[model samples]
Target: VERRIFTSKMWSLWRYGILLIIMVTPSHQQELSSQVLLDNISRIVDSRLAILDMRMNNIGSQLNDVANQDEKLMVRLSNNLEDKLAELEKKLLYNLEVKLSAIEEKFPNNLEERLSAIEDKLPTNLEEKLSAIEDKLPTNLEEKLSAIEDKLPTNLEEKLSAIEDKLPTNLEEKLSAIEDKLPTNLEEKLSAIEDKLPTNLEEKLSAIEDKLPTNLEENLSAIEDKLPTNLEEKLSAIEDKLPTNLEEKLSAIEDKLPTNLEENLSVIEEKLLSHMEENINQEDRIQGVNEMKMNIESMEENIIAAMNRSSVLLQKAGSTRCPEAEGFFMSSGLSRQCFKFFMDIERSWDSAVSKCLAEGLVLAEPYDPVMVKNYIATKYGMTGWTWINGRGSGSYITWQRSEGHIMSDIPYWYSGQPGSSTSSSHCLLLMTRQYHMKNYPTQAFYANTCTSKYYTLCELLME
Candidate 1:
């Protein structure tokens, strides 16, 4: 029985060794040919058999154990040793076959062919044989297998845990490196796009700018070309009217100037123009013209200031003084009496009245056209707007000289005169100046805004 067990163990070990040599040998090794693998397996099996034979010979050579022991005890001890060796051999062969079978299946190529060859070499009744051997196995087989099973799961768990820990750390480090690179790559891409966009936009904008002025000039030229003849004529007419308007304003300014300043300015202007037309020394003429222009400008400003003077001191016009007639006092028809109307300065309504009162004279109360004409005749050339004492009180018109004595008739009003509906038009003024055409008669009365500054009219009885 021990011999049969030993033979079976050696057969199993030989099969296991053949499978391991074929399956576990590296393909790159020079000694890895099929013949070499088979030779190696045979050598391993022969070596194991020789070791077992040597061990058996050593046991046999132990004559002292045989001589010292009783025959029965020696046979019993030999049986025990054989049983122990067989048990060990059985476990080793079973474990080797299992591990070698696993490795053999992992061979990627010629698996079917190799398995067929192995099957031809193997016993045909291998399963039946293994079943018979298992039935006769020791009762401790299950316990031994269970111990191996228990040791395998714990070792596998520890190995898996170690692998698991190392794998995640390496994976996390790689992922971190990848993540770090991503933002830099994205930022570089974005910066490149940002750099390109503005340059492209600037190029486009420059192209537009280059085209704009030409387009604008063309459009303007087209519009100008399309303008109607009447529009051009209208512009020409306005241009023609500019000089006339300017002359009229100058004439008005001249009228406002004092008589002496007006005469002096007129003489200087005429002389300058004559010198230019006669082709005088151009530099001298220019210098003279510039000097004269400065003088005229200064005089014009002074004259305007004098004409528009409203805040005047009345203490200079004394109470005992009387209006001078300039020897033209008339006590004849159309007037009870008339004295010279002299006004060199402008004043407000109150100031004008106070000034006249200081002169012991009254503001003229001309209610009819005959009185107005008579009064105007006293100063024939008196022109421009001037203030009279006619004022409105509630619904009644009254003169300052004859308060409460309302006038019976409205003599003459300029086109939109009186303007009595307006609160500002509370006083009366004589619009003596004409513009463009003479519409109103000379010294025509007009209702005016009271706040305006104007020359005052004073009257006194000629005795």
Candidate 2:
């Protein structure tokens, strides 16, 4: 590479020297000198290129030697070559810059532009070579070098500090002045929030102060009565769910309260406030809530009975019914126990049963047909059907009853009734007060599809 560079420099200098000679030559010798100079320059270029070809041949031989080496040695050799090539590239760039600078210094006005142009073109290859070097650098080494560069202070902090030092110390005062320039209402709103801070805190503190003594006594008594077995057990189970210091603080307060009730109450109040703030999260609290719900559900029967009895006396005469045999006997004429007729509400047979069950009742059972017929015809002002708790299943039709076999023996069908082909229409309903030409009884029962929505009649069996 050095030999090639030397040859290139020699060729440039020789050409320049020849041009200078030609310029200084007498006019009569100029043409001959120019022709001779051209031929000499051509011969020099050919010889230099031939030398370069020979050097390339030597380089090829070295490459073949490198290729025949062991893998580890080849790797080491390749790494060394890369390092040397990078150094060479750096030296070349430096030399080129120095030469350009020297040329500019010698002919500042005439050659500065030319020097700059050369400098600009020099970077095209340099950049590509530098990229190759960077690609060959060890990944860890590159990362560490990048980290070092980052760590090297860029004076940003110093500049920021200088800028900050130039700023006025009375910046807050200036801000307050700007705030004062705001509209009066906005300022007033902000002032109101600021002014209420103390009052709000004072109110909260006063509330806590007022409740402290009572709460302390109550908590102490509660701890004594509830703590030993139940609370302690529960505390153990849910210790992780509570604040770590809560049980300890409670125990401490409990121990101190008896001897120093008034004195320690303030401490207890503070602890209690903190404890209240650090409530068990919803997930933990929900566990206890679920347990309580299950307990409440277990007493659902008793609760429903209580609710029913609570509302029983409030019902007007003839509306309330007494438990009689398999059903309730209402003064309104044999309304079944737990049976309620809803004029406005209509539901399918299944839904009607569910609705009744939800209200501690079931759908009305048509046990006493004459009584049911009398109740239905009298009560309803319309001719719509009322669902009853009678369903036909296969050959053995059944009706809902508390006891005793179904009243299948009864001959209460309206003419061609129970409809022999009523495979799908099995649910029974009472047809009330119809005014058709056939003169069929208004209190007739019919077999209809169970899914049909009609006026619901619900029965509530008395406990």
Candidate 3:
């Protein structure tokens, strides 16, 4: 029974060794002809068996050492060694099972299902689905734009004709009427005034010359004769009348003066100095007041001149009108500029600019983007992206058709806008859609690619 058990144990060990050898073999070697693969496996098995025989010989030597001891002690050592070998075999089997399970999980069980899923996600299938959805969308915007273009020209022509009828047809006749209202003898009246000016000035000068005295030298001589000549003799006579003890009298007056005279003099001097300072301050105040008056007068003159210029400008604005053309309208703001919105067609930034230039106009620049936004919203009810006359260089954006930089502080830009000039998108676009959750104003500016097509805005300045 022990020999049978030993044979079964050896068979199990041999099977495990063959399985391990097969698992560790290279894939290319395994793909060899069946007979060649079996030969390689047999050689590996023979080598492993030789090593096993050596290990068995070592075990026999260990057993011989145990044979010198008591029989019960030898049996106990043999059982312990069997138990350790069994534990190692179980551990090796567990590790092999774990590795096999991991490899099995890596590959899918159904190859057909995996291939079908990848095929469904291809580009051609996606394109077909997108085209079907696009066909269902409405064509309302195109119809509306077409209708507007068809009717715009006729309405504009009629309005222009009516305005032309109201304007003065004969400007020469009107000028002649104005000339008739002026005085006929205006030249003669100016000449008479000029004649009187020189004659009046000459007569006045001659009359003054005649009134002057001729004996001026004789009168001066007469006055000199009447004046006193003995001034020194008179002074000597007055000195003789002075008292003999005049110095003594002065000395007595000085002795009777107050003891604090020096102090009093100092106090009086300080008071005089303070009074002088006060006077100087008053003078400064007067001078400042005079200067302020002069400034006020100059300001008043400037204000008057500005008012006169503004009145003239207002009159000119009222008389002038924008050219009668389709798509052109006057600005609602004080600028009163003529603007045209080309909504029916789309063009690139450069192409749009060229079209405007060909038509004797320039691409519209929104110096006050808010005003332009409000005007478009109220007038045409338009809300879409369009190109303006703005371009960027580095961090700075400037109007392509006008002077001055487009300031970043202005609220015209959409959030996180005005991308770097070196980037592909550096041209300016007016975005009329709300892209973010925050409620930003419409017609906000966006940095966009120059090659992208969009509707254009053109400006016409009427002199």
**Candidate that would win on lDDT:** 3
Per-residue lDDT of 1-463 in model 3, one digit per residue for the tens? 4345555666676667556656887766654544565576567666666777777888889998787676878789999999999999999999999999999886557657757955764445567657854664344657646744754434466657754655454544554554454445445545454443442444444443333234433433443342234423433343333344444533444555577765676577568546444533553323222223334323332333333333343445657787788888776533466778787778998988988888888888754454565555555556566788887766867776554456553435665666544243467776643332113432267778889888888888665
lDDT of 1 at 47: 76
Q: After superposition, which runs of candidate 1 have C-alpha atoms over 4 Å from their true positions?
A: 1-324, 327-332, 367-380, 404-409, 422-425, 434-438
Which candidate number maximizes TM-score? 3
Q: Give the higher-lDDT candidate: 1 or 3.
A: 3
TM-score of 1: 0.26
Clashes of each: 0, 6, 0
For candidate 2, the TM-score is 0.27
TM per prediction: 0.26, 0.27, 0.31
Candidate 1, pairs of clashing residues: none
Residue 343's lDDT in candidate 2: 65
Off by over 4 Å in 2: 1-338, 401-409, 434-438, 441-443
- Give per-residue CA lDDT, model 2, range 115-172, as digits (tens): 6755764544666767865775555776657755755446657756855765555555
Clashing pairs in 2: 328-337, 338-459, 338-460, 339-458, 339-459, 339-460
Clashing pairs in 3: none
Pairwise TM-score winner, candidates 1 and 3:
3
- Per-residue CA lDDT of candidate 1, range 96-190, in tens? 99999999876647768757855675655778868965765556777757744754433456656744654433444444444443432344444
